[model samples]
Target chain A: MFAPRTNRLAVLARDWLRRAVPRSVRVEWVRLRRLPRWILEAPLMARARVEDPRRDYPICLAWHESPLQRGLFEGETELERGKAINVAIAASRLDGVRVDRFQVLSYHHLVGRPSRRRGFAPGLELHAGEPAVGIGGGCCQVSNMLYLLALRGGMKIVERHRHALDLFPDRARSIPFGLGATVFYNAADLRFENPLPFPVLLRFDVRDGVLRGELRAPEPPDFRVEVYQEGHRFAREPDGWIRENWIRRRFSDLEGNELRDELVAHNRCRVCYEPTSTQTDEESRAAGPR
Target chain B: MLRALVKGAGLVAVARVPGGAAAYRRLTRDVLGTQRGHVEKLRRVVPGYVEIWRQTLERPLEGARIWIHEAGWTAYWPAVCYRLSGRAGAVTNCEGRIHDQYLSRAIAGAIATEIPNDLNDPRRIRRLRALLWARQSDELFRTLEGTLHERCVPTNLPLADASRDLCHSGGVLEHYRPDELAAFARECRRVLKPGAIASHVLDHRDHLWHADKAYPFLGHLALAEPLYQLLHGHRRSLSYHNRLSPEEVVALFEREGFRCLALRRLVLPERIYLDADEAARRGAPGLSRRYLAPRHRAISEADLRTAAAHYLFQKS
Candidate 1:
């Protein structure tokens, strides 16, 4: 939603200060303190194994990467560094991770907060409904990808947070915005509880400049998961308009027969960009909700 | 390696000739049949109505009331309307006389044939795609006359009571404002008897995307509302600019007392740019600055963007 308007001079002054200090320097100390934590967390990393499998994962559990990468990590250094940190998370926390029945895969409990000291670079991030730069800024990207894999892999999500607003444009976007998960260090995390009888393997790796990940188990999933957006609209709030969407989840049998489609969550996020599309059909009218 | 060299030499030889690209295109279109559209060929895939009953209706089309608005001049929606409703007591076709006649013809042509719908009822589409394949197009047109009561209206329809068994619209509601659409929906609801159905192909894409590739589908959002009206509105042009996303349309239907039965939306996956400076140059600078609104830039992107939505709703 829209924020209160500040005086132009104040806006300019704040921007000048922001530029003077630079976000990298501003968030450095916050990340530097994480160094000791990272060291202490080293033992946890060893628990997650990174390996190249001698055999391929089941085709059903394959990961697909996105070609729509603009505005996600715009700068080259930030982009490469974000990817490096993503690989680091895959190596140190996600790779070879296993979950037995009823066991939870707590994102923060296992991987910990992505820290600058852990070698994360400044990348695109959302702060207070706006895109901003921060240490381990794009850590949410990895978590989001993992969240999707877990869902499709039939893992039960015990806790997840959606971004306040969809910041990226739709042009060539790979997944629906409202379907994503937003992680903020230890406070906001993604946790999945395995419901299957067998243990499931969580794997992540970089493939051709894109991050590819998957959930592998001996048997194909019994219930299939597909996520979609529904009832998406821009609702006017007191301050400004925020985009609203319902992330709908559909379950199907392994044989590809649909069982039911249910509403998973209602995503209400700030609108951070102009929503314009051509009107090709007849103009139609709508009344506000009754 | 030898095959690669031969292929490269062939390409060089073609490049050496004048207008080879044009010639190749001509050959492709003429020899490869690119210019021809296969109504007959398409029929093989979708099959016919008569088979539309892969699933049965609680209310059969027989002696039912139905409405098909903006069926267009040559569209075959009436075949679908009639097949589902069958010799319905009454049928309403909005878009005037000629459009109604076309509907009548297609329905007649399809009367004799009842191929089972080939899709096995998995993909959701109501109308028969091969309604008037070229081979049967003329016969279908000649014998379209039927005894069922048929009415045609050009714009706003005038009808009363819970009379219609079914009401349908194909790709027409996207041009009206949400309020006008809501009114139209109310009209359908009023005319339809309780438990009747309303269905549509509800296309929500920016028509200009395929019309011209100069900009992203969302490029029109860069211009201020006033400027957009100036160019595409009835003030200067006949084109209507609804710019309503699929979600907005669904919301409108819901508000108008329609229960969603089925919604299969097509998501477009493409990133488009609408920069602030670009928007300013395209429209008024001051308005463009507002277009870039606080903390938001000219560029907007999202995945699973609904290009079009196909839905069925039952009147409550």
Candidate 2:
């Protein structure tokens, strides 16, 4: 159910509104409005928390690293470096944390509120579908890496959040688009539960300007998990150009025999920046609606 | 603008001559030689350069692995700094130009004789005297080889990730386009360890004013984008300026995840007339609002007149 030409008109109107107002004003306003919800959700999240600080002889399972900085789109401010600081602050809280069997590990529960008093810095963050700079902005990078680690380690995702808008052009993207998980404290979070009997330790570090995360266990796993992206494509929809992909998870035995294959996530996000000429030309040729 | 038009035309004419490619290459070399003061100017300027870095860093630079962008033929800035202060632990000169063996040694030899004897450090002075006594016969290059790593790369850096503690450059930022600068900033973030710093010296004034007195210091800002590109694009092989304001320069790196620590600006006394309005009051031909591109047109007069700046940025 898409209305033709509506996407382009809405985009133009949104852009006009954005230019009319100052970004700092808009960001401060949004932060002020989100404060009440953030305060109320703090105790609600503490109700189901599980503390698993017991460490065992570690067996590393899955590891992933994402760069803290990426090439920015035109007119966008340079908040990525600030984001790196935020990521480090948030990632340190996640490091060495272990999730026990049937225990739900909420991202906000561990990282807490990314408040200035907690040493979080101003960084690029998306608020209400618009990119803005706010306190504890780049914490999503930590959640994104943790999500990837959880998926590859065969953990069950309890709750996750994805961005509605893809904000940047892919300059040196290693993973498929729409793979990152966005987090905004208690309202939007990444939560995963340990399905296996053994505890899974989460290790994170901001090493060499990359957010590195590793999933570890007490003993070697009999099965190895792998993730593959399928049917990755961009489409011109009524609202805007949208990027979509299917994340497929495969379970393999230690001896390399395939055990099971299953669909993990189907992601779709509206493209914020204009597609490059080649993408535009390709989309124009195959599209039903302009 | 006229000077750029003439220079551009002359370059085109020179290309039409026999063996013109070689001739034009030599001309570009001469341009760099005169403008950059290749080696002779190095001995005089190296000490001041080191002092500026010292003041800005507020600490000793000893044992810091430094990656210098666009270290020219001699790479003598770091070379002399290494020899004199003994501060740098290692130096890697990343340049787009191929390293010249004979020229480097010769330049090192010549710079050795010109080393100021009034220097404070007796050990450094003794080292210089030893070089002169030995006739500098490849001793400098051999010593530098032990600590200095020079590699010619067009885009990507050859160093390992998080290997360098400091990434620095002088008079180089304006030469890169916005996209190229964005890529370079990303590379800097990738190579430098977290909390490491990048120090850059930028000259925002028009380069044409260096040689030609006819061109105003802010004349480049007055030209139309198309006309400016036509005269000074990459094919010109001259000093092509991207004409970014100091704020824009800082923002470009910041966008690539660099946090600005210190920005020291220098506005020359002569260019005090911020924009055309101030210039009109003074009855001088100044940068006009009408002539500037729409992007440049909106810039504040304070930003328009910034002649140079030293930026100290830290990797997050």
Candidate 3:
């Protein structure tokens, strides 16, 4: 369902790099090690590419093009996936970066599923989203998680938005607001730019129900990078359940200090108590006296 | 006036006469002569804060570049000339009266609430006035001495042939009648450089009068009553006919081509009022009024909200 889409993304990425690099700047392409399941899996295999391989540039990775891209992942035709990837290519140009290629490893089956069910396996427990038939329900987390990794790697953010509410209570490992990415065709997108002079290698892998991202670059100088929280809270209420969260951030030595804070969402709820028909012995005795 | 004069003379006669009926009349004449002598002595020494009548004689002469108004008594003009121009400058009575001009009853009554029985007595009251008036005149004369020809004139002439940067009159403007005020404003405008800033601390509508009117109920009461006439007898008020409101003062400045900047009200402390009252009891009414009215009978906060208004202006 997603294989041909991955190949089309790779082709679109190639076309993007061909057009994005300024004629004055030289361009090169390099391939990183590919996992077998990510590269040759049932639905689609993942592949990575680097632009300006000789000079250092930050690498950005995303799961799908848009909410419309969800249709492609759900067994939509190659033409539909092509259209979605084209929108991403056009959007990526806004940041002055080339979209090399996005590799989709498999359909995220756990998406749109509730976090708990009776007797559900402990390892297979889905942590985000409700059990519902949808296209882009849980895909935001993948992009959100990736966005945090990019920010921590000291990459310049191009566009991002916080969730309407926090879906996860444990935000220590979560992406900060203005740091998380959201992409819906022609509506929202996760974008970043490479500010460094050197090329950055973006490596992605999913293990033990966790998605991990790694950035590889040539060592410039021995400078320390620290991530600090500014102690801000963001509260979100989904339906009737309330969740409070915080944002995490990183600071680089060259840039002095940086702060990450979250905005809280307010909720209004009212409770009304009604009298019951039951009468106690005391009430009955008081009634007789009255 | 006759009763006061006769009773005053009779009191003096009683104080001096020690013998029979014939001596009484003789004592009366002697007391009257003594009173006249005291008046003459006062005429020679009591400084008047304003000299409105002397404007004509003190007109500036040719080659006079700086005109200092109100050269206070005891205002060491020689020292002032040395300090300002390193040479002597012409000294003139621009506005204020010499110490001798304020010797009469009218000026005394206008200045002090209590007239001492023996007005000839020299005390701190007389000395302080002389000192202050002298200080003021000295400051003015010294500032302009030797730099420019001095004149004791009321003419509103510009500082001709000299580059004028500042045109300031601290205690001079409030003495002007409405027309004089307007003319003074015009003169200041004519003399000052464009965009020059003028700082003036002027009393508009005698602070005591304003306080009295603003807090009529309070002014009649014990705590605030004594403040009513406190500032009434100062030479600044007696020498000047018109008292302006803050708004009117600002309007006058604006009419003279000045833009208003800031207006601040300063409240006199209680101790100053006590000192003035004590001085008034000692026979210096003007000094007493100058210090007391703003201190004691001055309006309360609520009254201030109603009566208080002062302004600053820049020459446009």
In candidate 2, how many Å is residue B174 off? 1.6
DockQ of each: 0.01, 0.00, 0.00
Against the true structure, what is model 3's DockQ? 0.00
On TM-score, the stronger of 1 and 2 is 2
Indicate which candidate wins on lDDT.
2
lDDT, candidate 3, equals 0.36
**RMSD each, Å:** 29.3, 28.2, 37.0
Q: What is the C-alpha lDDT of each candidate?
A: 0.53, 0.65, 0.36
Give the Å shift of residue B205 in candidate 2: 2.6
lDDT of 1 by residue, A57-152 (tens): 343453645421444435556555665565555444677776654355767767765666766666667875687766676667678878888767
DockQ of 1: 0.01
Q: Please give, for residues B1-316, the per-residue lDDT of candidate 3 as tens digits.
A: 3443344335344434454323443333322222223333323322221121112113221222323333333223322222222333433345333332112221222223222233222332332222221212333334334332333344445254223433334345655666777876676666655655454545432323432333221121222323322423223233222445445677788877888765544333221212212322332121222333433334233222222223345666
Pick by TM-score: 1 or 3, better one? 1
Clashes of each: 31, 2, 21
What tier of docking accuracy does candidate 2 attain?
A: incorrect
Give candidate 1 regions above 4 Å deviation: A1-59, A67-92, A236-238, A255-260, A279-290, B1-316
Model 2 spans > 4 angstroms off = A1-290, B1-5, B12-22, B25-52, B55-59, B84-120, B129-139, B145-151, B269-286
